[model samples]
Each structure stands twice: as C-alpha cells, then as structure tokens.
Target: MNKKIHLKVNTDLNATGEVLSWFEQINQPPLSDKKIWWQCQTLLIEGFANIVEHAHKNLPLETPIELEVLRLNEYIEIRIWSFGQAFDLQQQLQTKPELTDNFQERGRGLKIMDSIAEELNYLPIDAHRHCLFLKIKY
Candidate 1:
C-alpha cells in the first residue's frame, strides 16, 4: 500500500486556506514555484469551493469533507471525497449552458481545472458519495 497523508476539515472556505497551508508546510520547496504552485492551488481551491458551494451548501457546518493527498510513484494525487450530492463532471461539461454578456460568469472554473490538472474526474460510486480526483504531474 502507498503511504498517504490525510487531512480532514470542515466544509468551510477557511478550510481551503488551511489545506494550502498544509501543502506549503510539507512540500520540499514549500510551494514556492509560481506556476506550479498556483496551478495546484487553483485546482484545489476551485474543487474545495465546489464542495462548499454545491455539495455542503445545505448541510450543517459540522459535517466534514475528507481530503487526501498522496505522493505516488511519479505524481501527486489530491482526492476530495464527501458524503454529499452526486455530481458528474463529464455530464456537467456536456451541458450547453446559456451565456449572456451580463452573465458575468459561466463555466470558467471547471474549464480552468480541466486545463491545468493532468487528470480531473468525478466518481459517483453511490447515491450518497462523490469523489473529485485532481492529479498533477511533478
């Protein structure tokens, strides 16, 4: 089995900052490289933001989301697992969302994540659980 470092936090935006801080702490160079660091940070913050805004929006703050970061053979894997609503990333992408000039925002975050991460996926193993996996090559 691979050795993994696990961190769990409340479903709050503050937790996002905490997660980034954890990355900075353990990383060899402490997430100092601008391009690499921001890429990782953006993907994570967006995913975490999704959890906060969509998944746990109705749930009480005490309900936690589990974050697992593993340094595998050649890549780093970040898994955000929650016992919340089931979401499909592919289906979301296929959605033809209507956009207008005044819309201010649209499907930008997911697109950004898709572009940066080596692999980004949503796995709905069952009705009550959803896992978002974002992997980055080191």
Candidate 2:
C-alpha cells in the first residue's frame, strides 16, 4: 500500500506546528519504526524551518509553502516547494560552517538533514519556484 499527503502552509514560523502535525498523522500505522519516524520528523522540521527562516525571509508571511510526502514500502519521500531565490543544497554541503561555543543559535540544521536523509536533492523549478526533495529509508 502507498500513502501520500500534501500541505500548503503560510511562511509564518507558527505554521511549522501545523505542518508537523500533518506529518505525524500520515506517518502512523504501517509506518511504525520509531527511530526512522523520528528522523523523518526531524528532517521535515529542519527543512521547513530553513525555508521559513532563510528561503522566504524577505517574502511576505502570506507566501505559500507547499509540502508533499509519499510513503512507499521501503522508503518515504518528502518534497518541499517554495518561492525564493534558487539555492544549491549540494554546494552548501560542500562548505561546512564552523560551530561556535554558544550553541543557542545559528547553523546545524542542514548538517543534520544531510546525515539523516538517504537521498536529498534541490531544484529550481523556475525563477520563483524552488523544490527540495528528501528520501528516508525505513
């Protein structure tokens, strides 16, 4: 059996909670491995937060961010689409930022996502539309 879910959220930070709730609801039952589940959750949160904080930083809060999830037997795929300046995830990964002593703020989300996701891809659909795809294996 295959499962799919789609969510369109405002760019506001508060919308993260709603997006996460939808993620959890669809990732139940047949997808019962807790460790993998948490990894997916973390990736989802980090990815969305990245978009809100960096990608659409200058855009209006009313801007819509689209998220899609597809669950197959062996792996789950998540795609996030937003209107922003195009970014290259691969190039970002090539340069690792230094982690300072004060850990309260700045950096780390992308590193965690890179480690957890089996496959991660970023593409610019157009001048304004960019998409990030992540696949996690169960």
Candidate 3:
C-alpha cells in the first residue's frame, strides 16, 4: 500500500533533528534497509540545512519550511518547500565545486544529494514559494 507523510517546520537548526525523527517514524521493520534509510535521511537533512542556511538566512525566525514524503511500490518521492527566497537549484547543481580534500567543509551537500537522488528538480510554487523535489528508487 502507498503511504504519505507531511511535515511543516520552522527554518531553524532544530529542523534537522525533526526531519530525522520523522524519517525514523516512517522507517519500519521489514521495509527497513540501513543504506537506503541513511540515504534518504541524509538527503532530507541536506535539503533542510540548505534552506535554513541560504533561503532563510536573512529572513524572520518564524519562516516555515514544508516537507512531504510519498511512498510508492517501487520508489519514494520527497518534496521540500519554503517561502523565503527564490533559488536556482538547477544552476547550483551544474556548478558544483570540486571537493579535493576530506577537510573541505563546504560545497558537498548538493553534490551528495544529486548523486543519491534518481530525479531532482526545483519548482516555483508561486511568487513566494519555492519547492525542491527529489525522487529515489529503492
């Protein structure tokens, strides 16, 4: 059977933990695989951190970010939305910086997410809302 989960949270540092907890709640026995679960969890945290760091960087503390997960028979889709500012994720994807050293502390989130996601796209829900969509096959 197909299932869906929805979460709405502030664009704060705490959102990362909330996202992880939500993921754990949905990752049940028989369906649980460590690698797949970690991939999804990582993507979710990266997406949340991106919005918190970039989109809401100068915005109000109460700004909201929305996350939705849809589970299908063969794959799962995650949609993340924010109303802070418009960002060109596609452009960012194309210009990923080279990671030469393990000590490099920046520019790896997008690349990692891109590698794991089967499909990734950015959609402007409206003039104010921006959405990042990611699909991963199990």
Candidate 4:
C-alpha cells in the first residue's frame, strides 16, 4: 500500500466535483499514458456516482460516503464505503446491456464498471456498512 488519500463526504450528488477534484490533485504529473489516467478517473467517478444514485439513494442525506484512493506500483485501487444494504455486485455485472436495447437513462453503471476495472468487488464492512472496490492496472 502506498500513501493513501481519504475523503468523507455527505451522501449527496453535489459532492461529485469535490471528489473529482480530490482525484485530480493526486494526478499531479499525470500518468505516462493519458488514456489510462482518463479511464481510471472515469471509473472512479462512475463508482462514486453509482453509490450516490443506487446504494445511498434512500439513506439519510447526512450519511457518510468515504473514498480511499491508493496508487500502487502498477495499479490504482479505489474503495468507496457507504452505509447501505449490501447487494450482489457479481450478479449485477452479469447483466450486460445489449447493443440493440432501447435507449434508457440509467442501468449502465455495472456494465461501465465491468468494462473498465481490472477487478471489481463488493464487500460488507459490518452489518451497517458496505464497500465497493475497484482496481485498474495502468
């Protein structure tokens, strides 16, 4: 584990920019491959937005959403912690969208996350908390 960057924000959509800004701060020199950097940033924001829209949707407005980003030798690990009921992320990942499907406003998070992350996982951090973990190799 390298130096970790942690942030705790209220479970609201307004905090997205703050999260993205925090992410950009660490991307100082930028990755050698700009595409990789952009992709990882997209995945990170998508993961955070998913939690806000799906996991913490019904929770209190004050509920905390914690984010931890770690840049290792070859990969970046992102952990998003929220106090929401645990869901089967593997099952969700299996439900891919078909190219012919009609246009819909939502239901693409799992697919987007699956397409980008080298490893996507979900775990319970006790009865009251759940974590969404994403790992992307550069």
Candidate 5:
C-alpha cells in the first residue's frame, strides 16, 4: 500500500479545497488524460458534499466532519465519519429514483459516487454516528 492521506474539515465550502489539494499531493503526477482527472475531482467533490450536506445534517455548529483516506492494496479507501443523524445507503438504493421525472433534486449524490468509486458503503452505528466508505482502484 502507498502512503495514506487524511483530511478533516468543517461543514463548509473549505472542504472542497482540502479534497482538491489531496489529489495534487499524491506521489504520481497528474494524469495526462483530462477526463480521468475530471472524474476523480467530481467524485471527491460529490463525496465530500454528501458528508457535509447529508450525513452531517444535525452536526453541531462547532464540530467539523472527520475524513480519512487509506491507500490499500489496489484501491484507495475514503472513510467519512459524522456525528449527526445516521442513515442507510441501502435504504436510499431501495427507493429507486424516477429518471423520467426531473422534478426532485435528491438522491443524485450517491448515484454520482457510485459511478466513480468501485465500491460504496454506508454504515450507521446509531442515530448520531454514521460512516461512508468509498473505494476506487488506484
């Protein structure tokens, strides 16, 4: 496994910058293919946004979200822990969205994450503890 990088941020826009910096800090240089880089950026941004907007729904104003990245064998694992209302990704998946109806603007975040990451998991320990795991091949 390569060196792992971790970052934690408050429920604010600043988290976006932190995630972007992580991509640059990787040992490998940026990919020559803009498409791959763009997809990576999108996944990171959406993943962070989901944590802030969805997982941390009842987070205290003073507490920040905790995020950790683990570089494991053949994959990068991103774990986001939150001290807010817990939720289940499986529930979200069960309620399949209606693609033809474009009125509601919900449930898209997880969908996007599913697209980029090879695996995605949402676990809830209790009403106030939640964790999201996203894994992508490196």
Candidate 6:
C-alpha cells in the first residue's frame, strides 16, 4: 500500500502537535510497530523543532514550513521545506558542531535522528530555502 500526506504550517512551535496528528493519520505499520512508530515520531518532532529553532529563526515568523510524507512499500519518506539559508549537513556531521533542542544536551537530538533515519539529506531548493529528507523503513 502507498499513502501520502502533505501539510503547510507556520514556523511556530504550535504546529508540531498538528504535524504529529498528521503523522498518525497514515495508519500504517509505522504507527503500529512501537519501535518504528516512536522513531518516526521523534524524527518528525526533532525535524520540525530544528527548523523552527535554527532554519527559520531569522526568517519572518509567518513564513511557511512544508512537510510531505510518503509511505511506500519499503520505507516512509519525509520531506521538510524550510526557508532558511542552506548549510553543509555533511560538514556539520564531520565537524560535530553543538546542537541542542528545547534544553536537550548538545547533539543528542541529532544523534537520535541520524541513527533512526535510514537516509537523511538536506539540499537547497533556492537561494534561501532548503529541503530536508528523512527516510525510515517501516
């Protein structure tokens, strides 16, 4: 079975709840498998929080953040669009820069995300916008 969900939300922390609700709508194994479900949810929350805290930090609060989730036969794909300056994701991983989310210790969130996601990528969509992709097997 294949299913997809798309949402466009303001760059506000409040939208995180809505995003989780959106994920629950998928009704797939990712929702039933406790380990996979938790991984997916954690990644979604962390991704959104990262965008709001780092990506869209300087942008207007009203700026839109787009999320597209696709559940395929093998894996689920999540794409997050943020209007932020692009950065070297690979470089950051290699350099081990400090990362903290909502009072969490540095780099903890990122470590979880990196370990959970089967694939993770960030690339520029334009001069000031970028897209983050996270794929997880269900």
Q: Pick the candidate with the highest TM-score.
A: 4
lDDT of 2 by residue, 1-138 (tens): 588999999998898789988997667674677889889999899889888998999999999999999988888999999888887788887675633332647677777788899998888888889988899999
RMSD of each: 3.4, 2.0, 1.8, 1.7, 2.8, 3.0
Model 3 lDDT, full chain set: 0.80
User: How well is each residue in 1-138 modelled by candidate 6, as lDDT tens digits?
Assistant: 789999999999988889999888775554667888788888888888888888998988899999999888778888999987788877766666444433546455556678789998887988878988899997
Looking at model 6, which ten-residue stretch has the lowest summed lDDT?
Answer: 97-106
lDDT of 1: 0.75
- Candidate lDDT values, in order: 0.75, 0.86, 0.80, 0.85, 0.69, 0.82
For residues 1-138, what per-residue lDDT tens digits would candidate 4 score against the true structure? 365799999988899989998988657567799999988888888889899998998999899999999988788999999887788988776665642462677777777778889999989999988989999998
| Tens-digit per-residue lDDT, 1-138, candidate 3 | 478899988879876777888876556543566788778888888878887888788888788888998888777788989777787787987777644432468668788888899988778999888888888887
Order of candidate numbers by lDDT, starting with the best: 2, 4, 6, 3, 1, 5
State residue 99's C-alpha deviation in candidate 1, in Å: 12
State how far residue 51 of model 6 sits from its true place (Å): 0.6
State in Å the error of residue 76, model 1: 1.4
lDDT by residue for model 5 (16-131), tens: 88778865665354445666556666667777788777766566555676777765556667777777766667787557564444356766777777768888887775766777
TM-scores, one per candidate: 0.81, 0.91, 0.90, 0.92, 0.77, 0.88
Q: Give residue 40's error in model 3 in angstroms.
A: 0.5
Error of 5 at 76 (Å): 1.7
lDDT of 5 at 39: 65
Q: Taking the candidates one at a time, how many backbone clashes does each contain?
A: 0, 0, 0, 0, 0, 0
List candidate 2 stretches off by more than 4 Å.
Answer: 98-104
Candidate 4 wrongly placed segments (more than 4 Å):
96-102
Task: Return the TM-score for candidate 4, rounded to 2 decimals.
Answer: 0.92
Compute the lDDT of residue 50 as modeled in candidate 1: 83
What are the runs in model 3 whose C-alpha is more than 4 Å off? 29-32, 99-103
* Cα deviation of 64, candidate 5, in Å: 1.8
Better model by TM-score: candidate 1 vs candidate 3? 3
